[model samples]
Target: MPTLYHAPFSRSTSILALIEELGVADRIDLREVGVARPDGSGGADARNPHPEGKVPYLTHGADHVRERGAIIAYLTDMFPEAGLGRPVGHPQRGAFLSWLFYYQGVMEPVLVLDRAGLEHPILQATFRDRDAVFARLSEALEAGPYLLGAEYSAVDLLLSSPFQWLPDAMPRQPKLQAWIARCAARPALVAVTERERAGLVA
Candidate 1:
């Protein structure tokens, strides 16, 4: 079984939702761990294998996966029957990988910096700003209801996540808001939220 080192209110929450979406909850070992929070209320868990001691770390057999995007990609590909991933030969594979990497490489950093009120020429040059990120999302969403055309995939869950965490940070664009709402309404997300609230997996 794969072991997921998770924290209740961190990025791991998204991974838990993904597991539920994949219907592989029974196949995974969900290990709750302590992660340092913004309020500085928690410390790292000694059992966590992440070098940075972060949540959402996964280990299966001799393989270990870290980072949100990588873990999503790994699990989706591992269980292709779930149909949450665009496999290698699929036409949308490139787009799928691009969205995953974009969230990790661009969207996340820019949003974090913008939220922190940090400004620097280097950051602007590298990842641009939240405007550019949102513009990219809006452009893709305009093409269809979800990030990858009509189908709701892991990328939709991922890209829409930050906005759910910080609703005030979400743009007022109708399409974007609608997409986020759609993702939020997933039963998988609801299950994860309820479990966390009940302290079942926190």
Candidate 2:
């Protein structure tokens, strides 16, 4: 069985949601392993395979996978029957890859910098602005349902994760809000949410 080194409420939470979306919870062994314990005695889990002690890294026998976006692409393609992945020749292939890469290449940095209220001219030029990121998402989601036009792909699982965006600010855009609700409504998310909660306490 593949084992997922997970930390509740971390960036890896999206992978937890993805496994739920794929309906493969039983197939993956999940171990909560990030963040300091409430007692403050625990820090940077010794079991974490990630050099940075990050959550959501996957270990499958001798193989290990890190990073949220790569994990999504790996697992979805591994189980294409779940329909969360756009496999090789699928017409939507290019867009699927683009959306997944955009999460790290653009959105992640924008979220961090904007939250910290720090900026540099080079970052602005390279990553563009948060507005540009939101505009792209808004335009895509304005079309409704999912980023990939009606199909709820793994891209939805990544992009719609509320953890990355602020709670109060997300509601300002109706389309984005609806998209979030749609993602939140998935049975996979519900199950993952429950699992995450249980794991945190355990």
Candidate 3:
């Protein structure tokens, strides 16, 4: 069985939702890791699995996976019965992976930079400009429903987390707002959010 090392009210919530959405929630063991306080003091838990000291780590047999995007990809591949990912050689596979990686590679960093109030030299930022990244995402989502047209996949789970957290941080993109509502309406996501909320309060 795979063991999921997670922290409440953090990125782990997204992974938990993915597991539920994929119908593999029962197959994995969920382990909660406590986060450090504002003073930066906390005992080692899942952080021991990664140098970054982040939660949402997964260990299955001899394989260990960390990071939100990597975790989703690993789980979707490991449990093919869930059908949460596009199969290899499928035309949508490339586009699926593109959006999956885009969330981590582009969106995440842009949000982090915005929240941290950090500035990058004009020519250095990978996304080029933060506003441009937001604009593109807003427009892409404006088409409505999901990131990939009408279908919702693990990529939506990956993309929804950041959007759900920082709604006002981005421009008022109507399509993106509608997409967020659609994602939030999933029963599995609602259950996971409720459970995670209870865990955080406890």
Candidate 4:
């Protein structure tokens, strides 16, 4: 069975929601873990196979998937019947892959830097600025109520996540807030929140 190295209320919660969306919650194992070292020099849990020992990594059989974006892509592909992914043959497949990569490649770094008030030349060179990232997201969301039109794909759960974690971070845009509302109202998300909260208390 796939084992998820989880931390309550972190990115792993997004995966938990995805598992619920895929209807495979019972097929997987979830292990609670603590925070990784602030610097990426070591793992939070030495037993965690992920090089950095992160709470949101996973081990699926022999495949060790790190990073929430990659995990989302892997899970959606592994359970294609859920229709959360846009496979190669699909018309929107290019857009699908772009969004996943964008979340990690650009959004993640920019958001972190923006939140911490830190900056680096490399990050600036690669992602431009947080405004660019938000602009792109705002443009995509303008086509909402979902990232890829009306399908309500895993992209919704993955991308809408930051807003959930820091509610005030969401811009004052009505369109963005509406999209986030759709994501929060998702039955899968609601279910996972309850389950994870109960698991944490236990």
Which sequence of candidate numbers ranks them by TM-score, best first? 1, 2, 4, 3
lDDT of 2 by residue, 1-202 (tens): 8888877766777887788778888888988775665456557879888777777789889998987888998898889999999999999888898999998889878877887798999999999887888889998886658999887989988987844336744645777777888887887778767766676512
- For model 2, the stretches where C-alpha displacement exceeds 4 angstroms are 36-42, 163-165, 169-171, 198-202
Cα TM-score per model = 0.97, 0.89, 0.86, 0.88
* lDDT value for model 3: 0.75
Q: Report the number of clashing residue pairs per model.
A: 0, 0, 0, 0
In terms of lDDT, the best-performing candidate is 1
The RMSD (Cα, Å) of candidate 3 is 2.7
**Candidate 4 stretches greater than 4 Å from native:** 37-43, 119-122, 200-202
Residue 113 in model 1: lDDT: 91
lDDT of 4 by residue, 166-186 (tens): 885786778778888889999
**TM-score of candidate 3 versus the correct structure, residues matched by position:** 0.86
Which tens-of-lDDT digit does each residue in 137-158 have in candidate 3?
A: 6766656467776777888888
Worst 10 residues of 1 by lDDT: 193-202
**lDDT for each candidate structure:** 0.91, 0.80, 0.75, 0.80
Q: Give per-residue lDDT, candidate 4, residue 39.
A: 54
Q: In candidate 4, where is summed lDDT lowest over 10 consecutive residues?
A: 35-44
**For residues 131-153, could you state the per-residue lDDT of candidate 1 as single tens digits?**
88888999998778999988899
**Looking at candidate 1, what is the lDDT of residue 80?**
90
